[model samples]
Target: MSDKKHKTLCAYVEEELQVKDAKSFISLIQPATHFCEGCGRSVAKPEDVCKPKKLK
Candidate 1:
């Protein structure tokens, strides 16, 4: 039995932000940053990396 907890990338980012270390953390994960590379706009979530399709 192991006593370890797993956290998603977003969860870790949120924790770093809460502790006022978001800038440093952001730099570390910049390659995986979820944003609009076209316009340099930051996205709200990591899942937002992919655009969703609309159904008619």
Candidate 2:
């Protein structure tokens, strides 16, 4: 691995997707198959969080 961490949902919200991009952000979180073990937030992809765990 490159040892590079994926961009987190929190960072993506604070850095990339802002209030004006709520709709876009929503799309990014839909159909969540996993959740962040560190943050406890559901996300579509494991890469979307700092620490990911399967939804099941």
Candidate 3:
């Protein structure tokens, strides 16, 4: 593996979904999944962000 440290940067993607039983049809924000550049792993949700630190 490379010595490059993996960091979890803040990121998001826009998504649209159909809703049932709506009056005026308002928009909703949903949690999106993101991938890590170093590990190439998928982050579960936006709330659970993995913040990594650099080694001096």
Candidate 4:
């Protein structure tokens, strides 16, 4: 899957799991997904803080 398509916490975790296992995992953890208020980017984990990129 392309990284751009996985724009959510559940999507990231889902990528690491089998189709059969994903449902169970989602139900178990029920992670609180967050989206960046500034750029509308989905934050997969709590530590996913937004940082400015340095231009070359």
> Across residues 21-47, which tens digit of lDDT does each residue of candidate 2 receive?
777678668999889888788889888
Per-residue lDDT of model 3, residues 1-56, tens digit only: 12255323222221111233122112111222454445443444432235422222
Candidate with top lDDT is: 2
Q: Flag regions of model 1 displaced more than 4 Å.
A: 1-6, 16-19, 33-56
The residue pairs that clash in candidate 4, if any, are none
Please state the error at residue 27 of candidate 4 in Å: 18
Better of 1 and 4 by TM-score: 4
Candidate 4's residue-wise lDDT over 1-56, tens digit each?
33453234344454664365666445433443554454443443543424322222
User: All models: lDDT?
Assistant: 0.44, 0.77, 0.30, 0.43
lDDT at 7, model 1: 39
lDDT of 3: 0.30
Q: Who is ahead in TM-score, 2 or 3?
A: 2
* Residue-wise C-alpha lDDT for candidate 1, range 6-28, written one tens digit per residue: 43344554566435776654553
Residue 16 lDDT in candidate 3: 16
Give the TM-score (vs. native) of candidate 1. 0.26
